[model samples]
Target: MYEFFRDLDRRWIFLMMFLCVAVPIIIIGATGKTFPEEPTQLVRAVFDEIENLPSGSKVLLSYDYDPASEGELAPMATMFAYHCAAKGHKMYFMALWPVGPQMVDDTIENIIKKDFKDLKYGEDYVNLGYKSGYEGVIKVIITDFTELYSTDTRGTPWSAIPMCHDVNSVQDMDLIVNVSAGYAGTKEWVQYAVTPYPKLRMVAGCTGVQAPLLYPYIPQQLHGLLGAIKGAAEYEALVIEAYGDKMARKDAGDNPLTDDNGDYLIPGKYTEGIRRMGPQLVAHLLMILLIIVGNVIYFVERRREGRR
Candidate 1:
């Protein structure tokens, strides 16, 4: 019996883990059992900032992630675009990483292109694609965007972009959102964009590994943060609750859905982040149980040795 359990193939454990995650994902996909997320203070702050803002506010969305974080960060970023688009805000898109451009493009393709087709190019929003300089780009963009990106991604001059005309730098915006993955992301935005320009309100959605380091800056420097898939889930809940109504207004051009008005009916691709949380919660629970069982086994063996 000891060997039966103790010498279990490593593949079995792996299979268990795979099923633990896979089952929840499939269940959620079919049943759509999303755990209710009560917005934390940080998440509330992010939601409220957008809520309180008047329509047509200028929002700078800086994509600071690569492919590595597209799973966790992409959903939040897409929702960020969705929320801003729903609110009728002008989104100025830019990226810091080389691959960041692709992430930015994903949002444009998925959210802006499909949902917000009414939004015009170079007028309602602009995409200033990735720049090589890390913090240097931030330093320059704090004062003048034209210094770094003289032309938009299409090789059009900044002056040609209706949204880019009066937009001098990060300071010109009402609020800034830096969706980051690593070193050149939210930290750089906070330091160069928010630190010097105190008036600039900034929020971030970063990867799980990097979330703890950013806690120190919370509420003060960063207005809100979406930390990993959990953060994305929370933000996803917020957006769904608040703006899910818009899907009901879908006209002939909209994506086909069974019940566009009902919850989970529209089925925006942003749900990926929230869906991941189901597996994460179950996996963490399994780990906790395993740890307790391990401790029990250790303590039992220790007592038996003492008797010998």
Candidate 2:
């Protein structure tokens, strides 16, 4: 039995990990209980800022993710949009990645339009689409938004978009909410937008791998951060608690799951980060147990040889 267990193929371990992830996901989907997540200061700060904002405040959402991080970053993006819309904040949506515009469009379709349908385009919110210059665009926008994105996704001049008509520069925004994956993301936004302007408030959400790297800038250049899916889940919980109940009373018989807090349980949206944690925790335990057993086997063999 020892030898059989010792010779167990790695594929067996992989199967076990798969089951650990797959099973919980199935159960969670049926029952909305995601492993209890406690929102850290960073998560709470992000939610608090939006909640405290005066209605119709100008908020810029920089979608710096591509299809690669869409799974992790998209949830927060949707949540940020919902939070801003819920506050009646005028949203100025734009993206740094070429595909980012599509992501913004998808979130609007899924979370915004489905719920905040009454928000008139060019008034309550405007999608500035995407631009190509990376950090260079940020440098330009820090001074002027129109010179870079002269027109909206619909090709109407910036002047035509009532929500954005008065906003001439990034400084005009009440907050810069940056959702990023890798390069040309929060780092770039911090370097070009938030860093120079002492008053340019910013909050961001990045994948777990990128979180550590951005730590030094937090609570300074970045007012707050949402780290990976866990961060998203944490922030989502905060949103649900603060806004979900309020929305429930007003939305009257409306499906809370569709646009309200229920959007946090978004199918496949929260999967990557939340689902990943289960396997990661199991894999870590398996590796630790393997190490301890290996050490025992080595010491036992050494003692047996000495006895002989």
Candidate 3:
């Protein structure tokens, strides 16, 4: 057994790791099923902030990541948009990163355009698109929005958009939902917008590595936070659990019954974060097993060498 383990090809371990991730993904994708999640306090706080908002409340969604971090960040973005749309909040989409606008568009297309078709653009929601000044843009917009954003992404004047009619600055927003991957993201919003205006409520979702750095601002500058895909999964679970049946009824035009296992027939797009967690969980377990096996082999060989 010692010799066998010692001689085990590195390629075999690589194959095991690949299978560990791929199999769960395939199963979850095919079945539309995902492992259950228990939301952390921070995740629940994010859900509560959006849930507690009255219908028709104005919400500003800042997408601060690009395609490179989409795999980690997009799920939360989609969930945030979906939750706000379902709650009947008026959304104002904008970005600090150059490619952030595209992320906003993608979320709108996938969630609002696809599921909630009754929502009208420029009234219920508007895409303000990307701005170039980073934190500087946040600093300006906190006081006077028109100082920078005079037009929406489609070249329509901000004055023309019904949603922007009463908006003078970011202070007008009932809540701010920010999804960020790096610099000039949640930190910038917290510093330039929420910190200065204590009444301006904010919540954020960020990459796993960035979560720790932003925790200090929570409950004060940031109302809540979602960290990486795990955080996204937890938030998604909360939203689906609360609103899935209502959404199903909306689609079927009547009350819809649960599936055989007592689950709502929610769309796959809404479950992206949950589905992603399956592979992540499996991959982590596989890595732990591999580490244990490697250590056993190392110790066994050392003992043999000492005896000889």
lDDT of 3: 0.92
Q: Compute the lDDT of residue 193 as modeled in candidate 3.
A: 94
Best-fitting candidate, scored by TM-score: 3
The superposed Cα distance between candidate 1 and the true structure at residue 252, in angstroms, equals 6.7
Query: Which ranking of candidates, highest lDDT first?
Result: 3, 1, 2
Best by lDDT: 3
Q: Write down the lDDT that model 2 would get.
A: 0.81
The residue-level lDDT of candidate 1 at 223 comes to: 91
lDDT of 1 by residue, 1-308 (tens): 54445455778778878888899989998886677777787877887787678999999999988887788788889888999989999999999898887888888998889878899988888889988889999999899888899998889998888888788888899999889899899898888888888888988899999989898888788899888888888888888877765743455886434453345464648677778889998888877876786676677778889999
Q: Could you tell me which residue pairs clash in candidate 3?
A: none
Candidate order by decreasing TM-score: 3, 1, 2
Give one clash count per candidate, in the order shown. Answer: 0, 0, 0
Q: Give the total clashing residue pairs for model 1.
A: 0
Comparing 2 and 3 on lDDT, the stronger one: 3
Name model 3 segments beyond 4 Å from true. 1-10, 249-254, 297-308
Cα error, candidate 1, residue 176 (Å): 0.9
> Distance from true position, residue 31, model 1, in Å?
2.3
Residue 68, model 2, lDDT:
88
Q: Candidate 2: deviation at residue 6, Å?
A: 4.8
Instruction: Give the winner by lDDT: 1 or 3.
Output: 3
In model 3, the Cα lDDT at residue 29 comes to: 80
